[model samples]
Target chain A: MTTPTPRANSGPSGTSDAPAVPAVPGPLAALPDADPAARERLHARLVDGAERAGLLDVAYRTLETPVGPLLLAATEEGLVRIAYGVQDHDAVLADLAERVSPRVLRGPARLEQTVRQLDEYFAGRRTRFELPLDLRLSTGFRREVITRLPDIGYGRTESYARMAAAAGSPRAVRAVGTACATNPLPLVLPCHRVVRSDGSAGGYAGGAEAKRTLLTLEAA
Target chain B: MALRPFEEIVTEYGPMVLRVCRAVVGPHDAEDAWSETFLAALRAYPELPEDARIEAWLVTIAHRKAIDVVRADSRRPLAVAEVPEPAVGGSGTGGPGAPAASANGQAQQPPWERDEELWDALKALPRRQRAAVAYHYLAGLPYREIAAVTGVSTDAARRAASDGITSLRRSLPGRTEQRTDAGARQRRAHQREERGERP
Candidate 1:
C-alpha cells in the first residue's frame, strides 16, 4: 500500500538507512522498548498540540467482538476510555484518535481472547468475558456502577435508579442517568442492561437500536 | 426519544475531542474543557448551517481552551531575582557582591531558560499552520477532520500541514542527528546496564 507522504515535521531524520515506517492505517502497533512514561509524555504533547489547534472529536478503535465489533476510545490524558462499536468504524476510530487520545493502540492481546470468548458466548459455548481489560477509563462512580453490572448475570437487567442506589448514590436517579450516559466502556460493562424506572430502555450512547439488539441477544 | 444536540454531539465526537484536550491540558482539565466545549457547541448548534462541519467546529473550540490555558500560564509572575547586596549599606571592603549583577541590578544567573528548541520551533509556526501540524501529526487528525475544524477546504488543510512541516524542517534540527545522538545515548546506557549486570 502506498504510504501517506511523511509529514515534513516528522521527528528528527534518523539514518536514512532506517526502514521508513509505512502508512498502514491500522491500530498503532507498540513502539519498540517504549518507555511508558516517555510515551505518555509524548502523547500528552500530541493531545495538547491538537487541543491547541482546537480539534476535539476523539479517535477510537474497533475490536472485532462476538456480538459485533467493539469501539474503544480514550483521551490522551489517561485511559478512562469509552467503547461503542457495532457501527461506523471509520468515524468512530477517527473520533477516538482525534478527540480521545491520538496515542491509541490495539487493545491488549488478551482482548483478542476475550473477543473469542464473546464469540463463543454468542455461539452458546461460553458465557462471560474473562480477559483483562484496562478499565482505567471509568471514574470511581462509573466504575462502581459498571462493576456492579457484569455481576448482573447474563440474561438479566437492572433499573437506572436501582443501579444508582446500588452504587451508593441512592438519591441520584439523575446521577444514574448521567453515569449510564457517560459509561466509558459500554457493553463490556453492559450499561445497556440498565433500563428506565418504568422498565423501558432509557438511553444508550451506542444508539437505542444497538442497545435493544444487545439486550435481545443476551435474552436469547 | 430524539437525542438532544448535546447527547448527539457527545456520542459522535466526545472521544476525539477529549483526546485533544487530554493532549494539551492534563487529564484533569480535559473533562472540564470537554464539558465546556460541547456546552458551547450545544448553544450554538441551531446557528450552525447544514453544510457546516461539526467536528471541525468542536475542535476549534477545544483549541481555544488550550490557548487560554497557555496564555494564563504566561501571566504568572517571574521569580524575583536574588540580587547581591547593593554595597550602599555595606562596609567599603569590596565584599563579594554575590555574582556580578547586570547594570539593571538583576542577578546574572543564566536566563531561566526552557531551552526547548523543539517546542520553540513548533511555537514559531504561523497559528493556522501550527494548528494544522499539531492536529494532524501529533493529535493525528486526518486531513478531512482537520479541514472540518479549520473551516478550510480539505486540500487547504493538507497544504497547511505540508507547509507547516516544511517550515518546521527549516527551523528544527535534523532527525538523523537526533537518531545518532539517541543511538549513542542508548549505547552508553546499555553499556552501563551491562557493567552493572557483570557484577
Candidate 2:
C-alpha cells in the first residue's frame, strides 16, 4: 500500500513558486507507527509521574464480569468506588470527579492488585478482598452499616436487622437497608450478603439481579 | 465548565505530539521528549485555560522538552556506540524501500525511510525554519501559534516554513512525483473499497 501524502493546499509548500513537491506527509503520517507496548509504557510513566506529583485525583478501570462491566476507581488513599455498568458509567465518573476531585484518569495499572483480587473472587477461589478500603463516600449511619458488612463473610447472609444490630443500632434496620442500597464498594465490601429478615434478597446498589448473581456465585 | 480529564488530552493529541517530537529531535530522542511533554502537561493541566488551544499548548511543551534533550545531548558527549535503540520500538535504521506499517495498520512503504534526502534537508534548515515547518506543517499549527512558540513574527514563521519546504523540494527532486503517484493510487484503492469493489 502506498502512503497518501498530505494535501498540497494544506502544507507550507502550498503557495511556493517552486515545482510542487508532493505535500510532505505530516509528521503524524510520516513518523513510524507507534507500538502498542511502547504506548502502554508511556501511559504507565505518565501515571507514575502524576501520582508522584499528587496530580492524580482519581484513577479508574473497567472490568468485564459475568454480570457486566464494573467501574472501579481509586484515590491515593485506596480503592474508593465500584459501580456496575447499569449505573451509567459516564455519570458515575462525573459524580466521582465532583465528590472526589476532578483530576481523574483511566489508568488500569493503578488497580492491578484490586483487579487480581476481584478476578480471584469472581472465580470463587478467594473468600476475601485484602485491599485497603476508602470509605469516604459513605458517612454517619450509612458508614457505620457498611463498615460492619465485611463481617457478613463470603457465603453467609445476614438480615438487615442483624446488620443494624451489628452497627450498634438494632432499630435502624431501614437505615441499614438504605446503607446497603448505597454501598460505594459492593462486592469488595460484601454488601450483597445482607438480606431481608425473611431470608429474601433485599435492595442492592447493583440491582436485585446482580445481588442474586453474587449470592449464587458465593453459594456455589 | 470543567476541564477535560488529562487522559482525554493524551488520547487526542498524543500521536500528534509524538510526530512533532520525532521531527524536531529525530526518532532516537523523540520518546523521551514525548514523555516529558505529557508529564509536564499533566502537572499544569488543571490550571490551563478552558479556551486554550490544546494542540498548541502540547506543541509548546514538546518544543521545550526537545530543547532540553538537545542541550543535554550536547553537554554529555555523544556516545555513538552506547546510544540506546529508538525507544518507540522501531530500529530507526529502516533502509530505503523497507516495509513499514501506517498508523491504520496498512503495509505501506514509508516515504521518510525511502527518502533520506528529505530528512537531511530538514535538518539542514535553520533551527527556526525547522521548528516552523514541523509545527505548522506537521502539527498543523497556525502561523500565529508557530510564531508564538518559536519567538518569531508571524511573517517570519510563515517565511521560515515556506523556505524550509522550498529547500526540501529543491534538494529532493523527483521524490514528489513518486509520492504523488503513490498517493493517487492509494486514493483510487480507497474509493474502490468504499464502493465495495475491493474483495
Candidate 3:
C-alpha cells in the first residue's frame, strides 16, 4: 500500500472489529493460481462476444499454408494485414494496433473467408483472390504498385521493370521492388508475380525460400 | 504513443480481475463474472481515457459484473452451492468437502470449486467489506480508489478494509501465519491432527 499501514497485530487479533488493515500485503498477495484452461475458455468467449458486438477492431487468425503460417488480420473495413512467418507475427499485430486500431483481438470468424481463399490458393484450386482488403498501410507510389499487383495474374511472373511501367512509373523499377518487398497483403495481392527482369525469383518479404516455395507450388 | 492492443490488457490484468471476482462472487460464479467484466471492458475500451488507472478501471468493471452474477445466483438458491469452510486445515481432496458433498450428492464437484478458505472468509464478510478488502488487499487499490469503486467515502473505505481484514484474520489467522505454502501449512496442521496433538 502506498499509504503507510498501521503496525500489524495491534495488540493481537484480541479486540474484534476495526483492526488495522494488515500492515503488510503478504497476507493476500498469494491469490489462488488460475486454471489456464479457464483463462482460455473465457478469452475465447470474450472474443466471440466482442466480434458479434463489432468491438473487435482488428480480428486475426493464422493459417498453415504451403508458404508457411500466415497471420491474417481484419478491421471493420476488411482484411487489413497478412504477415508471413518471416515477418514476425507478434510485430505484425503490434503494427496493426498502431497503424489500424489499438482495439485488436483474435477472433477467427472474421478471417474465415480469407482463410478459405488462402487454402484454395495453396492447394492450386484458386488462381485469384476475391477477398476485400484494407490497404491503408500503403501510400503514394507503393500503394499504387500493390493496388495493381493482382493484374500480374496467377502462375505468371512479371519483370520488376514491367511492373514499374504498369504502375505509371516506368523509371521507378526499384520502387516496384520496394513495394513488392513490403506488400502487406503478399500472396493475396500476387506480389510473388513480380519477378526479377532476368526471369529469376526475386527478393521477397517472406524470404527467398518462401518465394521459391510459392512459385514452385503455382508452377505445378 | 499508441494505445496497447486490448489483448495485452487482458493478458496483463485478467488474472488479477479473476482474483477480485472470486472474492466477490466465489469460485463457481467467478468465471462468469470474469467473462462479463472483460467483455464489457473490451466494448468500451476504445473510449477508455489514456491516463485511466488500468487496474482500478478493470476493478470498477469487475465490481459491477460481480453484482450481476450475485443477483442471478440468488434466484437459484439451491444451486448457490455454499460449501462451508472445513473446521481445521485439510486437503480439499479429502477434507470435509467430501462428507458435505455427500449430503447434497454433489460429490462430483469440479476441482476448482473446492477448498478456498480465504474466499470463504471473504465471502462471509458483509458485501461492502468483502469488496473493500478485495479491491484494497487483493488488487492493491488505495482507499480513495476503493472509495471510487465501492462508492464509499475514503475514510469509510479504509474502515471497511480494516474491519474486513480483522474478521479475516480471526477466521483464518493460520492461513497467514507463515509466508510459506498454504498447502504446506494445511498439511502440517493436518499432520498435527493425525498425531492427536493440539493443532
Q: Estimate each model's TM-score.
A: 0.36, 0.75, 0.77
How do the candidates rank by DockQ, highest first? 3, 2, 1
DockQ of each: 0.03, 0.18, 0.18
| iRMSD for every model | 17.4, 8.7, 10.6
Q: How would you encode candidate 3's per-residue C-alpha lDDT over B1-199 as one tens digit per residue?
A: 5678888998878877887787778866786788788988987887888888788899999999999988987896573556432212112222243345445654555444555666677678999988987776566676667888988887788788878877877666544321223223223322333355222
- Candidate 2 local accuracy as lDDT? 0.72
> Which tens-of-lDDT digit does each residue in A1-220 have in candidate 1?
3232335533323423454332211111111112333233333333333344444333333556544566554333323454555346555454444433333333232134545665686676665666445555456776677777787778788898788878888887887777778776666677888888888887888888877887888888
* Candidate 3, superposed: residue stretches over 4 Å from native: A1-31, B72-112, B116-120, B176-199
| Full-model lDDT for every candidate | 0.52, 0.72, 0.74
After superposition, the stretches of candidate 2 with alpha carbons farther than 4 Å from their true spots are A1-29, A32-37, A51-57, A160-178, B79-115, B173-199
- Whose lDDT is higher: candidate 1's or candidate 2's? 2
Error of 1 at A195 (Å): 0.8
Q: DockQ score of candidate 3?
A: 0.18
RMSD of each: 19.7, 9.1, 10.6
lDDT at B104, model 1: 42
